[model samples]
Target: MKIDQLATRACAPPGLHWPAPAAAAAEPAARQAGAALARQPGQAAEQALQFNRDASLQQVALDYLGRLEERAVGVLQTLAARRSASAESALQGARAGLERTLEQRAAGLGEVLDGQLRAGPATRARVQFEVAGLASLRAVQAAGAETLLFSVGPQAGGPLAVVLDEHLGPARLLRRFNASLGQAGVQVRVEADSRLLFEIDEAAWPALREHLAIRGEGRLFAATGWQVPPLREQSLQAELRQAPAGPVLRALGEQVLERIRAAREYFQQQQSQLRQQLGGETRAAAEKRRVALDFVERLNDAKTTAAGAPSHFQLNARAASVNRAIARSALTRRSVLGLLA
Candidate 1:
């Protein structure tokens, strides 16, 4: 018989006709009841397992965010302390640290998503981190024209001569230098008046200036002496320089602060959503357990009812025992025996 049928019969009105009990009937009913009982707990157990996995991933995300935040804070503190000093090396170190932290944050987000995928479909659907401003920061670091211009170096083999185009604007001129120089550790910039400004390390500037000739259109200007100048100038004026570390450090610090602020806000919102989801899952798991427990109770009652009543011979034996108990009570005059009678 089906579990539902057994349960209904278990709760039936007294005097209702029931099927005679036999091993054949009893065995199937018991097996059906046991199967149903097993299914209930199986569902609850699966839900609990899923909930635990989600909770563990949440902790992993929290730990990753905490470490990222700490690293960002340390960078900010170092920048603040050395803001006034001409600590170029220290400032560069701090900037490098900030860059490393940003890279780590991106990697951490990837790991979090991978973990969610491993966890299951439910977690993947529900959990997501918003990286709003981070992409832009990374883009600036990776592809910003100025950053490219400042970090270029000389090409492989040797210094190559660059022919400047008079028609090219300041931006084009800057790109031209990077294309020729590769990343020669030379910093190039454009002035307000469309003049290209080049700065290289003081110790190395003389050798580079002598070897790397610049060919530009230079027309002859007639003066009182009536002299004719060459069609092109072979040399370009550049500054033998130290990098202006103070302003660069300050700018980097501001960028780092902005990135941290945006990331913190995003993480806070994500954490709040995760907590709310966890709470809902917890309630759902509790309800599932309660449902499983109720099903087990009903299944137990069904099995008991399916056991059926005693035989006619057992009824006769009970009546005979009652008669003996009554006779004994009459002789003993004991209240306990009287109650039994």
Candidate 2:
């Protein structure tokens, strides 16, 4: 399902399921202000209770993610072959859980995102960037499609997500960047959805932030209260943020369109290269390549339901097919071993 729909499924509010005893607790919180001392004579015990409740919720959320992270990391570390898939799925679940918890906590403060934005339908693209890491030099192609990615780092403990390519809107980048920085303990005030100003409490390297801002556009979003590092102490941090489009970001969107058309052609070359690498003169590794390729195709076919729709049981069924494929692969391996014997 689409991320928004998935969140709704999980965090639909508790329906004011106030407990019989707790009902009285809400009664006096609003009136607690009226009881304020004419001569500084009273304490707002009710308001204090509310504050305590909110703090408890925050701790609960933190504890949940911490425990979940430990479990996911442990399972992923041990499950060698299937670990990547498990990790991807687990990452999505954890991030979604965090979003839902925050949504509930922030509802009173008007901080939650509208469940599913009623924007234009998604626009997509395919872009190529020249990536050079010494021996890793190559032109890498990536699909700039409308999908959400949860980015995390020390500064970005929370996930920020972008739904689509910037050609549709720069706001997407800003939102994702905001969430990412938000989780990092940065204070972000989006002047508007498109513009952001942030304050970082602490940073490992400050110059890199300035450098990125310059590339994005001068003061596209200002950083305040940051202590600049000396030239000698300054550091270069590689790949802090994923590739994003600038204000004048080339609408290589059309270029991306052209490249999507080139994909069938590109696929032929990729198929050949993969086959040759695996199906070397020494022995055929086509079996492994086949297993991996089938997975790649299935991933391409999955689609999410719209925002308000019920769960797409059909998609879940397709996901099960993936499990069946894995089982069949194991069975095939056993059969091959028997034949060899």
Candidate 3:
């Protein structure tokens, strides 16, 4: 029979019977003590013999139980250590995989930004033109009566007009013109020397230039220095050299970079959690092993005391009770492998 089964039978209630003892002659002193106790008086003699027999059997059962527990604990400790090591290795591998995925995503995001940056100019078109001495034009008629008329497209409505004030500077004139023409896709600004610079979308410039007219009610277009200039289309290469990626493309790149940063932080947190879990498992296993070994030591000590004092009925009964409690405790506790399952 297993040590556990024998221990359980040895610790049963006082009236329950068991099969014949297997190692009855192993301890002659215990047998002789039982024989001597049997010679006492009436039923008391039989009770003494039974107590001695029970003590000897309980001691033998506890000895076997202690040895079995020691061997089982050793096996369980080795298995637990191996499992912990394997789990740690798997955790490290998972972390490495996550890091690699994050790095790949980051690299892909960089490539996308670089590609967008390189292709920025091809998707945009701009046209620029400058008007000469247009800032100083004055009315050939009455002062403040001069008006500049601007129109876009052949079939558009009446032209918009800007009244020339004597005190109007290029900056104020440009702002007034933009306020009128901005919806038509034309933007005007003042450059150095009070010259007017006009920017128009290349797609709209052709139609705008075809039927566009700028008329001043004065010597504004005469040789007195005011003149309208032809539109100059900026080359794609020149635009590329001068401009960074457009706002929309830049925003997209920034979003990708932010996502990459978030992914990195998530992976780092996962790795930290894995490390903490591994450490906790290691500590818990160590504590469980310590408790199991300590219990085995106490059990061994009880067996030794029972063996040395066979006539001490109180000590024998205590050891048997301890054995039954340990059997019940062992049934309730699960090994590491069991918990994992």
Candidate 4:
């Protein structure tokens, strides 16, 4: 139903002649007239024969042009069909390749993300000390000057010598004694207008307790009107209460990461199958792939965020140590004045 422009241009018009039809029609009459001139009779016949031959050659050429047009059109249609098939095949293959590439990349990312989500354990390295409550003491007197001495360790590794002035009041004397003890690396606090408050530093308590053998012949506390009530001897012990909530949070985090991973994989697989089934030039397939890829990228970002969260197990362990230290402090602080006495 379609016209070929090349064929139409190549063909000659109907009812038209290479030599004008009017001129051909006049040829016989001109020959007949020439015959009447006996002197030019043969020349007229020869001219008539040449005219016929020319006409025949012209007709043959026109037929050849028509056939050539037909053949050229056929060749062009064949080439176009072949090219179309080749292009279609190549496009399909390209889409398949791209889909495979996306799938492989997603798989690799999933592996890395899964590793991060289920990451390994970590060591707890932080040391903590927590103390609570207060201790108190009244002043005491010492009996000697310069000669009076005190010892901390059972073997007396650090010996302290004290000399008391009787003229100083109990409060003033206690203040002076505490000041001197501070210079000797023994920290103490006075409170309640009369009592001393105390709690040992966790870091220093262990070593100090192991060698504790306070000796002062009762003078260090006795000289300041300080009373010594036998320490209640509360047991120094602690239990881990209220563990770090990291484990619960970590478990939930891993679960969420797993969901993201599953979603990413689902989309990746869907896209791969789509590519294998459809051509790259297919608009529907391309749209689906775009959507799937976008979701995968979003899920990957979420996975990265989940992987960076703090480790709950490690946090809980550190918290437990801190709780133990607090409990130990509460137990160990019986009386501040007892240690000095």
Question: Which wins on lDDT, candidate 1 or candidate 4?
Answer: 1
Question: How much is 180 displaced in model 3, in angstroms?
Answer: 1.6
Better of 3 and 4 by TM-score: 3
The TM-score-based order of candidates, best leading, equals: 1, 3, 4, 2
Give the clash count for each candidate. 7, 1, 0, 16
For candidate 2, the per-residue lDDT at 170 reads 41
Per-residue alpha-carbon lDDT of candidate 3 for residues 26-145, written as tens digits (9 for 90 to 100): 345444533433332334334334433433333333333234234323323333344566654653443333323323321323222121112111123345655443532232222444
Candidate 1 residues lying further than 4 Å off, grouped into runs, are: 1-33, 36-58, 73-86, 111-249, 309-341
**What residue runs in model 3 are displaced by over 4 Å at the alpha carbon?**
1-124, 132-145, 222-229, 234-341
Model 3 RMSD vs true structure: 32.3
lDDT of 4 by residue, 1-341 (tens): 13774476459687643433444454465445334333322443443344334333333333332343343233233333445666546534433332233233222232222211221112111112221111323334324332234344443356555455655565665566456444434444455574554333323444444443333334444334323233221111111011122343234333433544554454345334433332332343246345534543443344335443335664455345434433333232212112212
The order of the candidates by lDDT, greatest first, is: 3, 1, 4, 2
**Candidate 1 overall lDDT versus native:** 0.43
Task: Report every candidate's CA lDDT.
Answer: 0.43, 0.33, 0.45, 0.37
Model 1: weakest 10-residue lDDT segment is: 231-240
Residues 1-341, candidate 1: write the lDDT tens digits.
79999899999999997664543465576467456544544454554455445455445555664564565465556656774555545656765654555445334344333211222222211211111111222222232233111111253354343444445454665576656654554554544553334544334443444444322222211122322221111110100012244455455445544544554455455546655655575565456545645544454445456655446675455345434433332233222222222
lDDT of 3: 0.45
Indicate the residue-level lDDT of 250 in model 3: 34
